[model samples]
Target: MQCPVWIFAACQSLNNWQQEAGSLPKIGVLAIQGDFLEHGKMLDAISMDWQEVRLPDQLDGLDGLIIPGGESTTIVQLMDIYGFRDTIKRRTREGMAVWGTCAGMIVIARKLLDKRPEPLGLMDIEVSRNAFGRQVDSFETEIHVASIPGDPVHAIFIRAPIVTNVGPEVEIIAEVEEGKPVAVRQDRLMATSFHPELTNDTRFHELFCKLSGS
Candidate 1:
């Protein structure tokens, strides 16, 4: 017997809609600290909608989240105080895409080189804070991210963390200085030791948006 063609067509259309609906996925930036406003402006430059996520409730309905660069200890303290640590972990477990930059990378790492507040431990990587040097040592360089198109990306490293090791599941997206990985990805989670929001480029954000289903 021949199946109804209209039913199959309608189902296909519905699937397409579901997929395309996320083309402009709603994103959230952790506004508890760091350059979240810069991230917001970057999102605007890319023509995507984003909000400052200052509370756990703000995490709801977000396709993806960005934790910007800031003082890792203070950020962790605030997250703990506001009960965002566990909430974010749960959301990531449910397949919410997340990207952490600079101090944000440290906050999400699984291991730290120093004794400090516990991070979200969502990314399976070991990090040494300020590996590049102190604030005075901040500098810029161009590196190619395999996932991003076009020319090399201009990376701004300000008191950056260094990824000393990565789990077997992690993928190194970019690196510098004798194969030191600076950007990495594991499933829906991404982390970079440099601040992409500080630049005018949108490739990293665009890549993250794609990961978040945008």
Candidate 2:
């Protein structure tokens, strides 16, 4: 006897689910500061395996890492205190993917217009911190991203940074204004000026997971 169409479809769906579960990447969320818990919840919603990465050693075996939105200066300070600067760079060189959001973007940029906190110099982009003004000036808007399909993404900018310049390798994913980039990707590295974790959308997280080869 042949399987019914609906039964076949259900079997295929179950097989896909099993494959996805088997290939789920072990992601790490930087928990030294910021909204790491929110990112963890987002990962949970996607049914991806993830954990809070507090120390540099926690980075081991992680397919990807997320730097959550918070105080850029404080995040950088804690990173240095925990000896993460070199270790993270090394991991990235070894093909570990990284995604940064809001202040996390500021931490990973190659250059920052403001002089103070030292960036990890990961992504080849220059950023202007607080380009959208203070927390009170925070706003939400829908923007189209080149990599994400379907409708525009709902971006929440809270004291966001804007990409002042991008290198040849960097791909501009989304922008709020002409000539200003809010989301960018370079190989396995990604950065967003808005807090995607604060919104209901999981496309950005899905994109990062895909980029991580999960």
Candidate 3:
């Protein structure tokens, strides 16, 4: 893989990227479930300001929040139970950047291919829950994300979802060689099937920060 070139040159190093710009953003990680702590650690390594959101009140003053990977159905239920569903929808609509990985992709999708229930429907694309099936089927591949800071990103898909169909307005940042959409961006919102936090590919996350203006 030749790898897609990174868009933001300032993002050379995750930590100093913000310092070079002379600002650190108030980022958030949805703690509704699964692999969220790893995201937090990634944020820390990048030297950006962030917090874990578990309540409606935590939504205040956040530039953006990453909805980490996990079981899709459970995260939505938790969002509803915690009164964050509407808040999340409203916030993203109001221009608060939202980034979701795996199950998180399932949550923000406007339509789910599996006929499952409870997606927040913040984005205009359609998604498939566990489109690749169980974790045992997990695999790695090099992907091209035009907005990132390096060559082809080594994407690790663990029981990941696939974005089957996309709306006209969505920008495809990453895709498989077969041309399946894997990462997308619409205004302040972004979602990916693979987990960038699980790998050394800080470009995707860093590109997100650039796009998000955080």
Candidate 4:
């Protein structure tokens, strides 16, 4: 039987990603907190080899690392308990690409409006935690990313943070409001206020893979 148009298109897109990405890089998903399994599934769909990163030691030799969306405070606390802060910084300095989603974005920001969570100060942006209000205010929308071409990316924001201030080196990839940035990238580091793993689209994953030099 012939597949539906949407299914065919999805398969075509996945195949195209596999071809363009060429030799998928070994990626690690921070599994200490949040919806890490969802990120893992997305990686799997793209035929990328990945593992759950709970300890700092597991970061060795990884081409890329993804900090999944979860409670920012809890993720940071677990990172401290597991001694991941310094190691992650070292790895990133060694040219390992990093992507942060939702709460992960807040964890990597240079400055956060909230004082509770001590960010990694990796990305050159100031974030306002829970900028979209409470969980009840969560919503999704289609947005155009500057680097990723074709269709607009489907972004899901759940108590998401917003980039209130961007530094000179940071590149604003996507924005919800005229001046509010929802996604930003700096060198090998990237961050998104929305949860791309929750969506069926794998373009973000593909983009990260390319960024990691897959």
**TM, every model:** 0.89, 0.90, 0.89, 0.91
Computed on alpha carbons, the lDDT of every model, listed in order, comes to 0.86, 0.88, 0.80, 0.89
User: Residue by residue across 75-165, what tens digits does model 2's lDDT show?
Assistant: 9999999999999999999999999999999999999998668899999999999998988999999999999877889999999999999
Model 3 TM-score, all chains together? 0.89
lDDT of 3 by residue, 1-214 (tens): 1223332243345445555767766788999798999888766555567899989889878878899998888888888888998898777766789999988898899999877866888888999877777879899988777776457888999988889998999988888858888999988899999998887556666666765565
Cand. 1 TM to true fold: 0.89
**lDDT, candidate 4, 1-214, per-residue tens:** 2333433554465566667766557899999999999999877776678999988999999999999999999999999999999999999999999999999999999998877699999999999999989999999999999988889999999999999999999999999866689999999999999999999887788788778874
Model 1, span 1-214: residue lDDT tens: 1223423432343345446774567899999989999999877766566899999999989989999999999999999999998899989988889999999999999999895768888999999999989999999999999987668999999999989999999999999998999999999999999998888776688778778873
* TM-score-best of 3 and 4: 4
The candidate that wins on TM-score is: 4
In model 1, the Cα lDDT at residue 68 comes to 95
TM-score for candidate 2: 0.90
Candidate No. with top lDDT: 4
In angstroms, the error of model 1 at 197 is: 0.7
Off by over 4 Å in 1: 1-22
